[model samples]
Target: MHRFTRILTRVVAPVGAVALAAAFTTASFSPAAADTAPAASGPAQNYLVLYKSGGSAAGASLAAIAQARGAVVQNYAQIGVAVVSSGASGFAARLQAADPSVDSAAATASFGVSLAGDAATDAADPVSPPTPAPGSDNLSGLQWDMNQIHAPEARSISGGSSSVVVGDIDTGLDFTHPDLAPNVDFSRSVSCLGGVPDQTPSAWMDDNGHGTHTAGTIAAAKNGIGIVGVAPNVKLAGIKAGDAAGFFFPEAVVCAFMWASTHGIQVTNNSYFADPWLFNCKNDPAQRAIWESERRAIRFAQQQGTTVVAALGNFADDLAHPTQDLQSPDNTTPVARDVTNACAVVPTEIPGVIGVTADGNKQFKSFYSNYGVGAANVMAPGGDSVLQRTAAAVNGRVLSTWPASRIGSCLRKVFDSGATYCYIQGTSMASPHVAGVAALVVSSGVTSPGAVAAQIMGTADPIACPDTAMYAFFPSVDNGAPQVCQGGTAYNSFSGNGQVNALRAIGG
Candidate 1:
């Protein structure tokens, strides 16, 4: 399994304002220290206490009493807290004794714990392999490559289009977008909040444009207005969990996952990061519950044979040096001397999810992509230049859908004035490329996320990245490193498995 390095921070707060408390006393802690506290003797016992909303008073009172009894409060959320006691015996009684307001408590012998292990010692320099010529435009043809190997290989393999449903668990989609309307699977696409049905047929409406572009990359209908998606035939189910500000809460994401699992969604694309300010969920009960819920949902998805694809975050730090970057993008002011890595790659790191990194033009890894050996299962074209246009001057760059809310915002002007299209760059963009391909693969009958990931990684063209001083820490061999940044042999960390060769991936 691959693991990205993360920075961990501790925020101790007063009982009255749990949210405000976290905002004030934020401090950095080492990953090991942040993740693990001394476990008590006997079996590791964990329990979740579900309290009524706004019942923090009751929850905190219970936590105080649990601390007195040498049981650590593992996490605290708005709804409840997850407590790990020293002894399994009589925990419910003790919890109830601590606070009678506890509505219900469920005990478990062990809770799933994710520990940052040692870095990969045997990781070698990248290797060079044969690569397709650039003009092949392998990255542009979304579903073609995936279908070549997994789905029925044909020019028009849209036969199972309606049967394959993809749920996008990202910023909301622009369901009304013209390019995406015809194929939008509105039946399954719905928002978790308010239990409202998706009114927009496209469900590709993005408040931040991130989700819309991602959705377009995955399964935008081939209406000839925008670029075709990898799984152009598949139906898309949009689940709007992220807020308008482009923020995704763990609870919301977990809820999206659970909803997707129950609603016949075969795959989901999660393109958000964890709170950059926090790391381990040990002290945060709400985060822990969300994490647990996400895992459970992922397990359920697997049982239902759904694939979950997630992006490795843009935090530019290594697993060994997870605390280096701590500056906020908006504020030059340093938030903390060091912070734990909370890249979006978490649930992906969990077994059964597909973790993706970004590369473009078959040569360089996206500068913002997070890279650790075994960390990312595959790579895809995320786009380098903001213009994302194949012909540069023609068509005024990429014609993908834009987030509905941001369509007229100042940021949207960068792409086109008064147009519901925007040009942005990040691994966030790259993830959907692989996701689109996965949908195509699923359409081709490859049902498992792991199997799709294996096919994508196994079939990619290997290239060596150029030895830019900025990427010095990235492993590169003499044979693989390209003389230029964009020109290299295949299979460097810079461009994992080379550019996602659709023709090769689909067995052309």
Candidate 2:
């Protein structure tokens, strides 16, 4: 399984302690180098450049772009987004200087994928129902999260549509995994590494297991061999935006959403936040540029009729009233800084995107889930080891399909068929459940993304906060501060709307 130790959400810091965000960025990409260095060993460092709305795509022609000491690697004409590569100093500045119509320009940020803590070893812990569920596949008994969302009952009403494609835009997918192979829409899958799209299926393969696990939860087959997905009958598209190392760069994110919009993707599941800042504070010029470019790509996807579902993140912070953020510029050195409404986590806080938080079998917020009154749109089972632990399910983590080739400390391999599975916990594991539900809703006759989102909210069950006074006493995943919930049964921060009801979502 893929495990990332340094993400904004995964850092288990002492209270008031500062920590690094996932895959800290290199401070600079200066052109200075020794002559003894070999030829460029990797893809050209790319930048995400977005043109102002209504700007002419041709205005960014090759001749004009060359003036910036950069060349276009890929041009998304419809969205006015371009991925450019340059070794020149002040690459972004040079590009903007050459084109005043460009709305924003920032170096594409990189990220290393985060791994859920010790989930693989926990899978080996003794589980109840020693065998599989009577009518389910091999690992169904371990999937309490599915039952929590009523996936079994929902699937009975609608298992999702063959034409409704749900794209998993993360580390990529393992097309060969038996459980996932049957549902993967290979023709729609592509690798958007370095912001350049490669149509070859192998290029989109899951070098890291995170994408495969999320894929399983969204659309793993119901072939009586492995665990079933929330919407077992829908087509799953793998948009390989995160690289082999688990980093999700800005260029890849822009490409992924644009790809989904152009293709027939009805929905997309986003688990990781875009780099290099953990929170893109609009007050900062560079950070504002990052958010603006990524926002344009996301907004364009929604405009194209794709419903976006994203994780609220594993950082147990109150997103709406953020006070201090010690983990900015995760791709580089992080500094302690205060933030306000001007700062926002991309995709999660972005309007129109369905933001999801995590809960456990106990129905409480996962210690690591980020929440705020207006931030999270819904909640799903993300698992909790501290609160939901039981003798059978010691870790209380989410179990899903795993990549067979990837070797990591937190992996649970199946020896019989060389196929594999693993356990992980995070909003990363939670968002796909909602995305699957959204796919089912779309398949069940709700035709538009707006309509699908409305159905998801309208069908959710309302939940009230648990002992507000005791919030300060509850243990948190980050071991920093206890979490608190606000609002009533109708809406709240901890469990938005309510835990996603797959059965209700599918008209059950």
TM-score of every model versus the real structure: 0.62, 0.86
- Which residues of candidate 2, in runs, are more than 4 Å off? 1-11, 16-44, 56-61, 109-135, 411-417, 468-482
Worst 10 residues of 1 by lDDT: 1-10
Index of the highest-TM-score prediction: 2
Alpha carbon RMSD to native, model 1 = 13.3
Q: What is the C-alpha RMSD of each candidate to the true structure, in Å?
A: 13.3, 8.5
The C-alpha lDDT values of all candidates are 0.49, 0.74
Cα lDDT tens digits, model 2, 375-467, are 888899887766677654557788888887874634444422556888778888889999999988877767577898999988887777777
- The most accurate candidate by lDDT is 2
